[model samples]
Target: MVQPAQSPEPDRSPGPARSSEPARPSDVPADHVVVLFGATGDLARRKLLPGLFHLARAGLMPRRYRIVGSAPAAEALTDQEFRTHAQQAVAEFGRSRPEGPAWEAFAAGLSFGAADTGAAEPLMAAVREAETALGGTPRRLFHLAVPPVAFTSVIDLLGATGLAADGKVIVEKPFGTDLASARALNAAIHAVFDEARVFRIDHFLGKEAVDNVLALRFANGLFEPLWNRDHISHVQIDVPEHIDIQGRARFFEGTGTFRDMVVTHLFQLLGFIAMEPPVALEAGPLRDEQVKVFHSMRALDPAHVVRGQYGGYRDEQGVDPASDTETFVALRVAIDNWRWSGVPFQLRTGKALAEGRHMVTLGLREPVLRMFPLETRAAAEGRSNELVIDFDDPGSITARFLVKEPGPSMRLADGDMLFNYRTAFSAQNFLEGYEHLLLEAMRGNQSLFTRSDGVERLWEVAAPLLDAPPAVRPYAPGSWGPDGIDGLVAPYRWHLPDRRDATP
Candidate 1:
């Protein structure tokens, strides 16, 4: 569903604030100004600032650079504090921390604004000032990295001040808590920003490995012809979190895996892998195809979806006891499309899972019938040609295919065509996920971002599931999820790694 970002290039425009555009441009220079709405929050402090800094480190900031972060808490915000803030993100997300002159250059490019102090006015002034300084028309990108609660306020202010209509606004996940809330938010956003101008953020789609799914299917040989129910028994999309709900317990309690992962993240990935090829890779065509996938998803009532909660985890330090939240989720979904019809697309995700992972596992059913005249039990169990794409740590891809053994009598054996990310490219060749996503956003490439319809479709499938009473079960915090998860992939025998530690 997502494509990896190319490295950062330099920002070349000559307009307002710090510069008119960002200082980097791995892709084409961004045509607009990026206004970061929540400049001082944990996300801004942790992911957003660091993400932008990484782009700058990669030399991807455009020529006319302006990073105007607007937070109601922005007033009284000092330049030194902003620098210290960015410095921390720099050390965290920036692969190689910049210091001395390089650090100064990067720091100089950043500027902050406060919402509490009437600083948003200054922020707008700064933006216009920067454009005036740059001597050209500049596009604008407003990244609403604020809390969901703050999103409405930010948009309201942006619109009140005429900033919202000036350019595009990039919104983060959990667009709404459920179908009703999502509709409300969409209506609110529609009031100011047109659907075309809104780009919802789904970071999963921007990963290098995820984007490779498209290339593997469309670009590779010997795949397109065999990519269907006859070939694929089912598909698996797993996005596990190794870390516990450290600080998100409050926000997460009101939400669960269905809202957290399935609605936007996993569903988007599914759409990409299952949707019809877009008439064109441009924003509208690509998004239209994905919207169709959403419409095609067999609307799951409460009966079709299942939820499991790990008991011991709530007793852990970070979780809440009164919570009924689901740390792990496994659901069997299907797309009513000719290509994926009858094939169950199992999506499993959780926080505090066995290990950290984000992967798409494709299981291709073996030949309908084997070489033997009368099939044996092994022959009945189709050989599974699995293609595993790992997005997080231990990144690599493994494709399992059937092969004939060299020594044994004409018997079929399974072998893997492995492509390890580490062995193929130096560890240094890879970029951080946050860095890649931020760069794409600045370059005006919405291809990696989620579309509005995509977001709504995800909710359509997940809202009913969330409302359904879950099949509650508990597992250890560090365990691989519920005990019965493996059964979902029963016929194919969920092929886990052979290593003992790999089970979790």
Candidate 2:
């Protein structure tokens, strides 16, 4: 049996002063044309198209907008052919099946252009056609969803052809192979478009749970006082996937789990968790705080890192038989700051694990005075008092603590107080990760996007591991990770996600 928790009264804390005046029409996003490069790729098909459709369905899209897709000339597709392909993709991958007037209106704006890096005429021609159809000179937003190797060339193409003039660009991540490349990429992008006009996408930051991290800390009075080293023993951020690389060996081989997941996703999440309170919730202030956290992070020590490769990874198509790529990585990170001086942030992510989970757990320190006796052997040894945030679909927050067991003897047992988003706010509509980010980009909000300095700082923090990466130990397909992982978090065990805690 389950009991529903009562909703608490609204907070009376004084927040940023607000103007009661209604927003002017100028606040609305201007009509724009989204030029999607690598339009035929997996990201476009699975996330971009469906995300756009969701925005359209929610009426969040501008009054008049167009989506122009561009791919290589060899994969050229006609206008109707591309529309048909997008229709199929949206139908298959969209949150809901395409139907009714919303789908029809969204489909009307779909068009395609086939062009390669060497040629820009085709892509520009498509943009012109879309502008003509829109009946105005709308703003242009270029979304580069291409491979990293093609980033500079496409950027150069955009610059040389004057397509980047007065237009914003959205770049997908694994921004660069390493620190030097990341810096070079930044230089090239800055040469073409100003930093303010660039939006570096990190879909993890767009998650509802991730966004709530700020509200959970700032909006509430219960957690702030205990957020520092004084109360928190260690922090663990774990993201493990059950499935292996689904035929993306070409990409995964070049970008292993460390670069793909650690530098990009895990570090970004860590920033949010450990960032200082911003003076304001605006883009600059918020981003400044996140960057400060990155600055405080100590460079990853190779001794504190664990790399693992799942068995049978080489059997996958396109993988090198002797590939040294890591499919699993566990690291111990330290943030040297007044607030988090002695705290250890344990981070781990892997593919082909026992189960799939995306969550962060903060282990609270043991009480100074221990007067009660524990009847259970597990409790006697010590059980972690934790605060867990689940980032899976329908996110949840849970607090694990000790409670008195009903018995003649004085004993204690672990109990959890959970708040699940789905049950607590059943009527609320949550946007998909990419959907939220795409909408924010269109609205010219760079708060959720990563900045150039932050990206470079992350690379610098991971430099040690990237330069002299540890040996990749082999692990079974369905295991948690290599046996060495346990050694990384000595004395403190990994917080294995409990399915029950996530259930509403």
Candidate 3:
């Protein structure tokens, strides 16, 4: 089996006491049933089941809850058989093994049902059984862990069977192939569920480090004043994965790096970085601000974009030998707004690269006046000031600046001020992306969920490139990307992945 990449474990050592309180009684979700579609799939075994187990262990789940797992008839397992499979999945993929009272209790709540395409009766029967066991008409949360192609069928099943009535639904990424498909999908979803009842999952936004961007910018006096074009030269959101497609050749062939990473993940991160402060931190205001950022974004220019395919990709199983699909992409995105007009936001993502990094870096402009001699200035200029937010597990924030060397003759050396999450917070308190997002959805907080308008706007922003994509260049595995990418961000270089500084 091809497992997903594992992030570093957080430090377990105790730190300062947590400043936040437990969720209020009202904030806790009421008794609910989570109907997990595609329950026998890889995502369910790898993330959804494990996430639910962790949430139960953390006491974040509702007191009365049940998980009704559904899959195609051919893949369905008996309830006891499904429980055994779930135990194995949790043992292998969960942060903690399933071996105690908590595991037993969680496993007892899991059951499986079978449903074929255009058929919702079996799944609805399973839901009814779960509700009967839970005693009341519990609220439902439908988690679509299926592939993008299966989204419409499952959604149509729900609407036809009255399963979507007053229930919230969570759908995964690659929402649509392009602008037209995105609009059509949005219309289909809106037909079944209202905007408020839809939760479009973008796992990147659930990371603590990503959410902290707002706190770091708005809550602090030092960063916000210099957050605009006047003080920042450029912004970089770089995500490079060392691992290739694993066994997902068919999926990768249909959806290249642009749709998989850029439209879904990077654009969301950009909204978080480039958006003006919302009136409040609530869901409506936050999403409004994000949509506004999308509104100001200039459509992607094909000339400023670079697409690349890793060598040997076409040899993978289920891949087309003549595939022109790009596994790597780099683009110079422009946000034609007041704050970020002059500053370029360079976004890049790739699979099978030299290293894997999830980071957002802001390059600070040089000082207005040069006080030092011109000869010595070159050395100082090379080490430009940078503010970086590393979103890998055990996240951190680092600010790089030039420090005066301790010598008779003045010289500058690179220095960094860093705040690491693992050292400052308890490891037990840390939540993985899926776990965090699952809990948030149950609590009815849509702050991290993508709205319909935002989705449409993102498609609009990417229209130019999708209409006429640049040719895909070939790059060797374990390399950064194509040679053509060098000119995409001229003068400014991409931030190479560095774990040494983030190490606790």
- Candidate 2: segments with Cα more than 4 A from true spot: 1-28, 375-382
**Lowest summed lDDT window (length 10), candidate 2:** 1-10
TM-score of each: 0.87, 0.92, 0.93
Name the TM-score of candidate 2.
0.92
In candidate 2, which residue pairs get closer than 3 Å at backbone N, Cα or C atoms, i.e. clash? Answer: none
Root-mean-square deviation (CA) per prediction: 6.2, 7.8, 4.9
Give the local distance difference test score of model 1. 0.68
Rank ordering of all candidates by TM-score, starting from the highest: 3, 2, 1
Task: Supply the TM-score for candidate 3.
Answer: 0.93
User: Top lDDT: which candidate number?
Assistant: 3
lDDT of 3: 0.85
Off by over 4 Å in 3: 1-27, 373-383
Off by over 4 Å in 1: 1-26, 74-76, 117-119, 316-322, 372-383, 406-413, 426-429, 498-504
Candidate 1 versus the native: TM-score?
0.87
At residue 226, give the lDDT of candidate 3: 97
User: Can you write out model 2's per-residue Cα lDDT over 1-504, one digit (the tens) per residue?
Assistant: 111111112112232111123234554467888999999988999999888876665556677888989998998888778778888888888864566556667777878887776687888888888877776678889999998888888889899988899899999998897899999999999999999999999888888899889999999899988899999999999999999998999999999999999888999999999998999888899999999999999999999999999999999999999999999999999999999998989999999999999899999998999788755544654456889999876688999888888998777887889988878763225677888889888889999999999999999988988889999999999999998887788778887656876885
Query: Tens digit of lDDT per residue, candidate 1, span 36-133?
Result: 77776777777777666555644665655656656665243555677777787767755556465446665665555666423456677656754554
